[model samples]
Target: MKYTRILTVGALMASLAACSAGPAGKAELCESFDQLGTQLLSGNGIGNPLFRAADSLGDVAERYSAQNLGSDAKSLHAIADSDGTDSNELRNATMNIAKICGHPLGLG
Candidate 1:
């Protein structure tokens, strides 16, 4: 009985982790952008750097989406092309986009 209980708990935990690890939903993505916008407007100024980064990321995302390769290896290559030339700016921009677009698409 003790072993059975432990096994059951382990299975439950594994299932929960798998569910949470799924891709971001549309709602989550929207919420991420909304939260970033709110932070920018809240006068923290910290959000300025992130906002600029997000803008760049948005441009990249748009371009990738246009080519229908936003989620493909081609997109990564594009990111590498952009980043390899300007490591600092590329890092900052990608970070901002991740923050703002980290959530699912329609979250907000």
Candidate 2:
């Protein structure tokens, strides 16, 4: 499933490379990314933690369209659309976004 998810996201990224507009910068992405990370770590008992995190990522991914970060955004969309994605999938996506933003998030 992990490999499948990566392959799927990779395909989406290839398509997103054509975009030239993205978020103002990675800092903008980290703002939303950090908030979602906080929520995920809080164990606040949100019904769909992965989806919530993914939704936040999708919003940031829009800004990175030119950088081919759409995979993160698209993966987030897939997660938000369904409630069955495993934590590993979301975790990988989170890590990828964090690396791009140069922010190390505590996503316990």
Candidate 3:
């Protein structure tokens, strides 16, 4: 009986871990967006590259949302593609998504 109880508890813990294992939540997405925006605002140039990279991140976030990966697609995309100057911010944000979603980008 004790062994059975232990096994059940172990199973429950495993299930909970599995449930919690994937993706950033909406709050995290919002925070990342804000950080990216701040970076963009502090940089220079036309800002088109930043926006383009952000758009790509937004696309991935939307796909994740469709798969129920814990982000709000509309909100994340809106925040991500918002105005900014820092190219790194956009790149980092997209890279973060790629890391989380297990999608790697290759530069040709």
Predictions in order: lDDT: 0.44, 0.68, 0.49
- Could you give the candidate ranking by lDDT, starting with the highest? 2, 3, 1
lDDT of 3: 0.49
Q: Give the higher-TM-score candidate: 1 or 2.
A: 2
RMSD per prediction, one decimal? 9.7, 12.3, 13.3
Model 1 spans with C-alpha error above 4 angstroms: 33-91, 94-108
lDDT of 1: 0.44
Best by TM-score: 2
Report the C-alpha lDDT of model 3 over 5-85, residue by residue, as the tens digit.
999999999999777555645555444445445545554346454455455446445544324433434443554457542
For model 1, how does the per-residue alpha-carbon lDDT over 2-32 read when each residue is reduced to its tens digit? 9999999999999998775555443444454
Better of 1 and 2 by lDDT: 2
Per-prediction TM-score to the true structure, in the order listed: 0.35, 0.59, 0.31
User: TM-score of model 1 relative to the true fold?
Assistant: 0.35
Lowest-lDDT window of 10 residues in candidate 1?
Answer: 65-74
- When summed lDDT is taken over every stretch of 10 residues in candidate 3, the lowest stretch is 99-108
User: Total clashes, candidate 3?
Assistant: 3
Clashing pairs in 2: 22-63, 23-63
